[model samples]
Target: MNQNETQWDKLLKIKTTGRDDSHSDQYRYPYEPTSYMVLERLANSGLIRKNNTLLDYGTGKGRVCFYLSYQTRCRAIGIEYDEAIYQKAIANKETAVAGNRSSFILCGAENYEVPVDVDRCYFFNPFSVEIFHTVLAKLYESYYEKPRELLLFFYYPSEDYISSLMTQEQLMFYDEIDTSDLFSGDDNRERIMIFKVI
Candidate 1:
């Protein structure tokens, strides 16, 4: 663990490991925890507020939800497709300071019903392009059902994700947080891509 992870673990009172992968064919991807550095940048962006409700897709161990909820004091909901990972997240949530306002649901992104009050969504390349499309449709439906300003945050977005996201007319590029300085290597593709939909 790095300095940030150690601090975060102490702060949240939970120990989590990154680069966790799964072999289950039903899962779209594995369990890789998002770096705390990227999340710190995202928190500093001020896109999330205390009133905003954030949905973290594929929330591995609920790190993003717990961190953001603690940092921004915003309500958070996490959806994890894997049962074991969901259990782990639940365990962590129990110890987090913002546990009362944070929830972790064990369900695939495709099946999750985007809450009407959810004004923010976080994606960290957790699923396939197909599942992303489905979730996008769900978001669209939820927005239309209860029209409200919403933001999508994608970190280290993949090319396929970019391509699929381009097809959505409602989402507009809002802002970005350049995270190149945080990493040592030149391949620091750490960018917090923000999109807005109203």
Candidate 2:
């Protein structure tokens, strides 16, 4: 963990400053927490509101759920497939500043059901494009059952993920949150892609 990550973890009263690639496979991605700086930018973007409920896929240690809920006052639900990592998230919630506004569930992203109140969703390439399609289907089902504004946020998306998302007729490109300046790399993928249900 770096100085910024440690400071943020200390401030949040949680321990989510590590990466775990042991569980990664062809379908499921590894556990990597989103940086505090990038999360701070997302929180200040004004896209998510207090009334909205955000669903986080592959929420390792529940960092996004805790940080976003704390910063935006929006209800957050984190879905984790790994039992051990899910336990860590549960532990973190016990002392998180926004614990009351956050919840965590242990289940595969493709099998998890999307709640109708979940207007915003966050993804960090948690799984392969095939599984993402299943999750997206669930989101669309929820949207169709209860028509409302639905926003999908993808940070550091891979080419496969972006291409599949672009072809989805139910979703339209909404906006982008650039984070290239925050890091030293000239990588073009250092940004968040925002899509809305159409």
Candidate 3:
């Protein structure tokens, strides 16, 4: 790897602790290296394609989008809710985009507008169910406005809520990847569920 790649990898390996309470004024944890490993695997396996548009909702520090863009040459955009973390993500985006690979926006996930032709959407347990539902509603509206293939990558997903929404919207499950080992302990089983519009 070159100097930029080396630095990117180093950033990916850094694990920032998340806030204890959901309501606390804190940023979400940065993704672990193993987490990126899983994302890389999915991309290599054709789950996330090259040259596709990717949206990382609640993207803290732009780690996922940065890695995806750097590795796959995919167009990536991240939306961060917290002001502090959003600024951090912006800084990270500048470093990653030294090669002009990625970009980010500082805004609430629910309030952000989905791009007209986004191919994939990513979420890493960004917020509460209420906010998730609102985002989904907007996504559904966008789909109706212009029908296209939408591949949703929900890491650390709320399966039950997703299932209900999928049923209501008639979306279909494409795959579910078990990424338990990405976390440190036995209980830290991270799951990535991929869904597509039916």
Best by lDDT: 2
Count of clashing residue pairs in every prediction? 0, 0, 1
Model 1, TM vs. native = 0.95
lDDT measured at residue 185 in model 1 versus the true structure, 0 to 100 = 75
What are the TM-scores, per candidate, against the unseen true structure? 0.95, 0.98, 0.78
lDDT of 3 by residue, 44-131 (tens): 7566666688888877766677777766778888887667776766665555542265677878777887887777888777766667
In candidate 3, residue 177 scores what lDDT? 79
Least lDDT summed over 10 consecutive residues: which range in candidate 1? 18-27
- What is the per-residue lDDT of model 2 for residues 1-198, given as tens digits with 9 covering 90 to 100? 579999888888999988998788999999999999999999999998899999999998999999999999999999999999999999999998889999999999999889999999999999999999999999999999999999999999999998998899999999999999989979999999999998
Tens-place lDDT per residue, model 1, 1-198, is 688887887888776667667644543877888888988889988899899999999998998998899899999999988898889899987787778889989988999999899999999888888888899999999999999989999998888888887777889988888987888877545787888885
C-alpha RMSD of each candidate structure in angstroms: 1.5, 0.7, 4.7
- Model 3 stretches with alpha carbons more than 4 Å out: 1-8, 11-34, 97-99, 159-166, 181-189
User: In terms of TM-score, which candidate is stronger, 1 or 2?
Assistant: 2
Supply the TM-score for candidate 2: 0.98
Each model's lDDT: 0.87, 0.95, 0.67
Which candidate, 2 or 3, has the higher TM-score?
A: 2
Which 10 consecutive positions of candidate 2 have the poorest summed lDDT?
A: 1-10
What lDDT is reached at residue 168 by model 2?
97
